[model samples]
Target: MTTTPNPTLIYPPKPSILFTNIHFYISHKPFTSSSSPKSNSFTIKCSGNASSDPKNSDGGLKNLLSGIVDERVDELLNREENRVLLDGLDKATQRVEIAKRELAQIEQQELENKKMKEYINQLEIRAAEIEECQKELLEARTLVDEAERSLEVEIEDKNSTMTETEREEMYKNKERFESVKAASVSAIVGTLAGLPISLTQAANTSQLILPSVITLISCALFGVTFRYAVRRDLDNFQLKTGTSAAFAFVKGLATLGGGPPMELEVGSISSHAFTGAVYISENLLIFLFAAVGLDFCIKLRILSPFPIETDVSTTKVD
Candidate 1:
């Protein structure tokens, strides 16, 4: 019973048909592993067949090597495609960041431009205010100048009125003084006229003739001095008042009435009449006549007149 053959231990010769079938199977379907099928599948097939037959092993090994090379090339190509995709993603992200930065910069520039525009507007408003203020200042100055001119005109008018009033008051005072002087002169003339011719004759022949002659001469001298004083006072008043007409009128009236005349009354009358005629003919000559006449009267009063005997002796032949 132990003499039956163990089929598992029996070694049979490899058949050509079996080797050819194995080669066909290896060529069509190389050994595949779950973990790394592309790299290990061809290597397993080549190693398994190399031990089976020498002639078939060489061809199988060559084909397995070619398949392994192709698998390695495919793995390299897949790795390259993944790397390109990652790089593209990174570039896209960088472009997006750059766009965001550009947008922020543009926004900042816009904000700055808005601020500058507002500042320019404020400056323009301030300039307008300054112009308005300047206009107001000029207007105020013009008004002040007009007010000053009006005040000056008012002051001039007031001064003119005051001067007119003073002139009127001076004229009134002068008229009153002339009236009093005329009344005094008339009273003196009336007192001299009351003396009788018989009394004058008795006084000339008697011992009292010297005293009477002296008294008459003194009276005549006093009358002449008083008349000249009144005329000089009136003339000075007229000169101060710049009224030559007033002085000329007083002189003409006094001369016609013979108030300041003694024995040479006709000469006095003729001279005064000539001066009055000259003053009436040309009013501009009044000032000169009044001045000369007033000066002559003052000089006549200052210098004593020569006695009648001396005058007669001088006229007679020595």
Candidate 2:
């Protein structure tokens, strides 16, 4: 009796008690028994949440990863912005260079146009000057031509007047010469007519008549004497006797007749009668002939005409 002391009745402990204890035990035991396993599971879940949430692992490790990702994103954004800015800057520089080049080209074109216009203006001015010079030259040539023509006309008129004057002088000279010749011939005839008479006689009573008759007789005697002398000389020399004989016959006929045929031989008389006649007649006659010849020489020289020459220069006109 004491032994199993109501093992059953002992209530093995009251059932509530047992259940409560069991519950306590079970709760406590599960906590104790699988504490390590549960801790491992909880750890795994926490790791998974942490990994999935991308929130935290080691504090330094989380910080490093966050910093690396942030730095990479910043680098990409900065690189893109820098590229855009560089492109903008390059485009602006190119535009500036193009503007500079265009400005230089416009300046160069303006300079060239200015130079061309200046050259054209100079050429036009030169052309006008050349035309004016040509006109002046033509005018000068025309003036020269006119002057030459006037000079030529004047020279011609002067030459004509001189020629007319010379012709008139020549005509006057010819007339004077003719008159002088007539006078000389008359003087000679008068001398010959008086020669024989002056030599024939010296009688005071018949002085006048004697002189006239003696002049005629002396002329006849001189003619006969000259004929005889020529014939004698021809015969003595055996030279051309025909002329001498003819002269002698004419002299003989003159001596037989009383005519003027014997008067031609008045220069040949040498007898006293003939010489006296010659002295009275030929002395004055010779003086007269000499005077007439001298006058003729002087007058001819005075009346002679000379030639004149004229020269003129001329220019051509257009």
Candidate 3:
């Protein structure tokens, strides 16, 4: 029996091919008695261009390696273990970027704070300067007020001086009238007192006229002096008495030296010393009468008091 020759199965040799931009996916399983051999074998899948030229093979091989590397990287990323590791790496990178951004923001905030602090310091300095300037202004204002007050006082003093001068000029006529009134009162008193005595002792009318005129003139002079001496005194007995006695003594001296001679009377003293005593005593009586009348007139507001006392009081008030 010619058995059919066992079929001679021969495999042809594969030609070398260069691949460019090719991707390959490979898988394998452990061989086991229950599994098919095909299931345990490695598998390869390829895509992209293939060439047999040696010159073109290098570039294609390089492209194939590059594509294979990219495919392997994609596979690794898809796998569970490798994907977890890549995810951890990506999260760590994101954290690093976020940290950098936060650091930049913190630095900017610190710079802004520094600028704000500087501005505040400048404002404080300006406020202090303003306070100092205000104090200086207040002091200047106080000085100006004092100057104005002093000027006002000076002007018032000048005005018051002018007023005093005008018052003195106006009162001159009044002073003269007072003098005339006092002198006339004294002359009348003297003539009345001396006429009787002169008539009693005179040798003739000629002697009477001389003694009477002399007495009248002397008493008039005394009255003017008395009015000034006791200008406003109405009730001072001592001043009035002293003034009368002084006038009487002066009149007696004048009569003894140059007065008209008196004729002797019956049953009367005739010595020169006795005659002098009579002259003094008679003048004293005449002065007493004049003083009483003048004092009465002063009390009745017939004359003004001296102006010197009023002027001194007004000056004290100013």
Candidate 4:
């Protein structure tokens, strides 16, 4: 060869072709001596589908590797231990999520407890203020009660001093009035008693004067006696009746003894008894009239019901 033959270039297999499922078979033989010089030859055979196109070979190799890897993963997952490990991993993830939720709830509970404590503290403060207000009210009430009692005592003392002067003034007026009333009543009643006797002796005016004077004096004295007698707390009707009767009987006895002279006669005892009865009966009617007049005056409120001294003394006790 004058010029070196052009060098042949052979490229290596692509990565995809290397991973493809391909099988190769090779056979070698030596030539026999009778035929020619010794020489060796090979028969090459390939198994499985191998593409000649580069793009197709790469795609087919990629598909074949993907399928084999999937089969191997399936076989590994089909084992019981591997299945249990996967299940355990899923459960662990769920437990982590649950723990995060519980932590959030715990934080919320703490916040609620803080709020409750603050509310309770406010209530305690309010209760203390109420107690203090109650204590102040009680003290104020105590002061008011003491002031009222003191005012009452002062009023009572003033009244006691003032009443003494009032009583003295009242008693003086009553004494003057009572004396005048008693004298006026006695004078009028005495004049009425003398009128009947004076008319009988109307012929001699000088003779009428003595009897009239005597009757007037006796009636005046009787009024004084009556006033003293009734001063005692006794029944009005009984006292008036008894006083009138006694005065009438005394006047009758006096008239009987001091009458014109009479000679002794038969049946003198009966005559004296009858004459005494007649004189007593006449005087009794006049005294009874005076008693009734005084009682009427009392009922009409013209006279005081109680004795002057006794009434004044009993006022303070009442």
Number of clashes in every candidate structure? 0, 5, 0, 0
Task: Predict model 3's lDDT versus the native.
Answer: 0.73
lDDT of 3 by residue, 113-169 (tens): 999999999999999999999999999999999999999999778757766556555
Off by over 4 Å in 4: 1-180, 231-235, 260-268, 315-318
TM-score of each: 0.28, 0.28, 0.43, 0.41
Please report the candidate that would top lDDT against the real structure: 3
Cα lDDT, model 2, residue 243: 32
lDDT of 2 by residue, 95-152 (tens): 9999999999999999999999999999999999999999999999999999999999
lDDT of 4 at 76: 62
RMSD of model 3, in Å?
A: 29.4
Estimate, for each residue in 1-318, the C-alpha lDDT of model 1 and write its tens digit: 012333665753532222221221122213223553332222132111124567676776588669866986566546755567668999999999999999999999999999999999999999999999999999999999999999999976874566545645655565455444333343333223323322544545575454345333433333334343444354455443344454435544543455444346888767766755653333223333333443454455532222212333332332
Q: How far out, in Å, is residue 237 in model 2?
A: 56
Which is the better candidate, 1 or 4, if ranked by lDDT? 4
- Candidate 4 residues 1-318, lDDT tens each? 011222352442421122322432211112122544443343323234346677986786588658865975776677677778879999999999999999999999999999999999999999999999999999999999999999999977875767666867777788667655654566467558657856775678788777667666666666656666776443667888898889889987787778754558757766777788877876677666666665566567675533666656676454
Identify the candidate with maximal TM-score.
3
Q: Write down the TM-score for model 2.
A: 0.28
TM-score of 4: 0.41
CA lDDT of every candidate: 0.49, 0.46, 0.73, 0.67
Off by over 4 Å in 1: 1-78, 162-318
